[model samples]
Target: MAQQQRATETKEALINAAAVVFGRQGYRATTLRDITREAAVTQGALYFHFDSKQELAEEIIRRQHTMSSGAGASFLASTESGLSSIVRLSGELAAQVLTQPVVRAGLRLSTESADDLAGAAAAPYRDWIGACRILLERAAAVGETREGLDLDAAAELVISSFTGAQFVSAALTGSEDLLERLERMWPVLLEGFVRDPDHPVLSSTSDLIYQSADRVA
Candidate 1:
């Protein structure tokens, strides 16, 4: 029992260490030695858990995606209003990108460079677009958006906007300012989505109806 618990802890520690290193150095610049050194574990221990650098990165991506998908799924399930749900989803994701190292690193690795991992690396835009499409459908059904609007296009735009905002913010501020930028981006998104911009159901960056965070995530 002790051996199993210790192994679990060691694997978690190594994964976290790798996320921090990958978050800072990116996949191309990172190495197994660097991760093992950061984790304070022997090379043999790393080999016991992860066979290669790409494998470790894939694990981090998987963990991060799981965490993020949970947040998104929660928003999808709990919200009463479609537009409000969309607003909160953006905030939630932005908050994750800003606060969660695993999420941040996974996003970077999935999108940035993967010639080595090839198709093994994930590009998250399509998944995110699908999630947003669900909310947009809800919003339209609730009369939050214009009737017969191209929801697919809107979802893509929303996904692209979030992606671009993070990429640019990471380049400029290492992503520390992600939520702040998200706060700014929300109003524009709201303007584009709501049925009545003047008297809308919610503000773009208003408090999330769900208990996700303090502000735009």
Candidate 2:
């Protein structure tokens, strides 16, 4: 039992250390030695749990999606309106990028290692788009979407817009301005497809951004 617990701790330590290094140096530049030094673990210990750098990076991306998607699902479950949930979930994800190193690293690595880790890098975006599609479908059922709105296109647009917003924010300010960016994005992005351009949810954008920014600040 003690050995099992120690192994778990060591593996977790390696994952976290790798994430930090990957976040800073990116995937191609990061080395196993760097990860071991960051983790304060021996090479043998790291190899016991992970076969190579690629495997460690893949694990980080997998856990990143699990954490991100799990939170999105929770936000979806708790909110009453599909539109409202989408807004709130976007804020939460932006906040996570700033606050969670693993998430930030995973997202960064996904882009940096896209060619090498194509499937792992792409999975999170695909899942996020699917989640948005489900939310748009729900909004349509409740008459929150415009009469001629294409749910699939709307879903893709929302995810893609957020992706661009977050990416730009990260590059400009290390994501310090991410929530604010999302707040600015929603109005212009949602104006076309939402049934009501001036919904209460729309008006709450500033508050939502401020509140989430405060939490992650």
Candidate 3:
């Protein structure tokens, strides 16, 4: 058990190191030697855990997918309203992307090297879209989303918009600004999608929402 635990730790350490290196230098410029050096492990040790750099990269993507799914599930479970959950989840995701260097790098790499990464990064996104569709359908059932809103299409749009925004923010102002911008944008986007008769305009209180989400998360 101890040996297995240690191996797991080492693998995680290497993944984290790779995320930093990949985020900073990009996948094309990164090498196994760089990952090993960053992880403070020998090249042979890295190979013992992962056969190739591509494998390591895929593992990173897998880990990220697991993390994102867990986050989404937790948020959905906690909130009664789907739209509210999405608004809250968006903030949570933004905070994570800004704070976690590994996650941020993985997202950036996924977009920049979609072709190079082959379908590694694509599956996670598809999974997220499916999750969003389910959530939107639920929200519609609860009268949270607009009537006649195409659940799948709206979900895809929401994910794509946020993903694109994150990419732009990363490229332009960095992760901090990305989170700030997401907080601002969430209400505006939700307002149009949500079926609130009383509160037609989704009020932007990102700070308050973020604080609440942090507590819930």
Candidate 4:
């Protein structure tokens, strides 16, 4: 039992160490020695768990998708209006990008290694967009959005805006201001989509941003 636990811990440590390095250095610039050194494990231990750098990165990407999609699924199951859930979900993801090393690393690796990873890296984006479409559909059913709004276009816009906001925030501030940027982005974007801009849930957007930030603090 102790032997199995130790091996599990070693594997987790390797994944975390690799994520931190990949988040900071990008994949091409990173090497197995760097990850093993970061993990404080021998190359043999790393080899025991993972055969190559790409395998480790793929694991991180898979984890990232799980984390993100898990959150989306939770919001979808909630009683909140879809528009409200969408805002809250964006804040939640922004918080993850700000505080979670694995999420940050996963996002960076997915973008950096798009060509290298082929279609695997794009899975998160596809899932996110699909979730957004479902949310928008719910919003339309609830009259949260303006009538005749194109659900597909709205979902794409929301995801694209979020992707751009996070990318720019990462480049300029290392994602320190991601929540702040999200807090600012949603109101203007929501103005076009919501039936009434002054709705209570819509008005509380900034509060949602702070709420997400406070969770990490």
Candidate 5:
């Protein structure tokens, strides 16, 4: 039992360390030695947990998706409406991109090695989209989303837009700016998609941006 616990801890440490290094150096540029060194584990220990760098990378991708989905579930749990839930979730995701180096690295490494990481990266995103679609459909049934809105398409658009925005913001201005931008854009974007006519809309981007900025400040 003790051995199992130590092994689990070591594996998690390696995955996290690999995520950071892979994010910084990308998959092709990163080596197992780099991951082992980062994890403070011996090469034999790394190999004991993962047979190869490819395997390690895949595990990192899997863990990233799991962590992201968990966050999504948590954010969704907090909101009653689908559109609002998505907006809140987007804010949460953006905050993660800025604050979580492992996540940032996972996103970067996955994109950079799309050809190699296709299976590992794409499956999680598809699952996320599917989950969002289900959430949107439920929201529509409850009068949260606009009537006649194609749930699957709407969910895809929201996920794609936020992903693109996060990538651009992370690359150009950093995660903080990305979160700020998402907060500013969320209400405006939600106004068009939300079905609730009585849903309170913050009139200006400044309102949301400043509110978030104040929290971060």
Candidate 6:
């Protein structure tokens, strides 16, 4: 039991360290030696768990998707209003991307291909789109969302818009401003999805979003 626990801890430390290094320098420029050094582990230990750099990158992407998708599934069903639920979930996801090196690295690596791990990188996006589609379907069923809106198209648009917004934020502020960016994004998205532009929920959420911005200011 003790040995197993130690091994688990070692792997966690290694992955966490590798995530930071990978986030700082993309997969193409990063090496397994760098990961081992960042992890403060021996090459033999790293090789024991991961045979190569591509394997490590793939695992990082897989774990990131697992964690994030689990959160999306868990939270998407808890609220009665699917639109509000998705907006709130986006906030939570923005927080995760800003704070978790593994998520950030996995996402960054997915965008910039260092190897043939495109499938690993694409998995999260596909899962997220599916999740968004489900949420929007629920919202439409409740008559809260736009009539005749294509759920798949709406989901894809949201995913792409948020990615662009997050990329711009990271470029300007080193990712410290993701929450603010997301808050700003909510108003635009709410307007796009809601059946009535003057819905009470939209006003309330917009108020909260701006209030946060003012506080930040």
Candidates 3 and 5 compared by lDDT, better number: 3
lDDT, candidates in the order shown: 0.79, 0.85, 0.77, 0.87, 0.72, 0.79
Model 5 segments more than 4 A misplaced: 1-6, 75-79, 195-198, 201-217
User: lDDT ranking from best to worst?
Assistant: 4, 2, 6, 1, 3, 5
RMSD of 6: 3.4
Span of ten consecutive residues with least summed lDDT in model 5 = 208-217
Which candidate should be chosen as best, given TM-score against the real structure? 4
In Å, residue 188's CA in model 5 sits off its true spot by 5.0
Q: How high is each candidate's TM-score?
A: 0.89, 0.92, 0.87, 0.94, 0.80, 0.88
The C-alpha stretches of model 6 lying farther than 4 A from their native spots are: 206-217
- Which scores better on lDDT, 2 or 3? 2
Candidate 4 local lDDT, 61-123, one digit each (tens): 999888877778888898878888898888888878877889999988887799877666988
State the lDDT of candidate 5 residue by residue for 69-132, as single tens digits. 8877764565455655565566555556666766777777666788887888788778778878
State the lDDT of candidate 6 residue by residue for 129-216, as single tens digits: 8899898899999899988898999999988887877777767887788777876787787787899888766766644434423432
Cα deviation of 144, candidate 5, in Å? 3.8
Residues 84-146, candidate 3: write the lDDT tens digits. 677667777776776676677778778788878878989878988988887787788878777
Over the stretch 1-217, how does candidate 2's per-residue lDDT look in tens digits?
9999999999999999998999888899999999999999999999999999999999999999998888788756764678877887887788788888899899888877899899889989888989998888888898888898988888999988988887788788877788889989987877877798777777786676666446554
Highest-scoring model, lDDT: 4
Judge candidate 2 at residue 136 and give its lDDT.
Answer: 83
For model 4, the local distance difference test gives 0.87
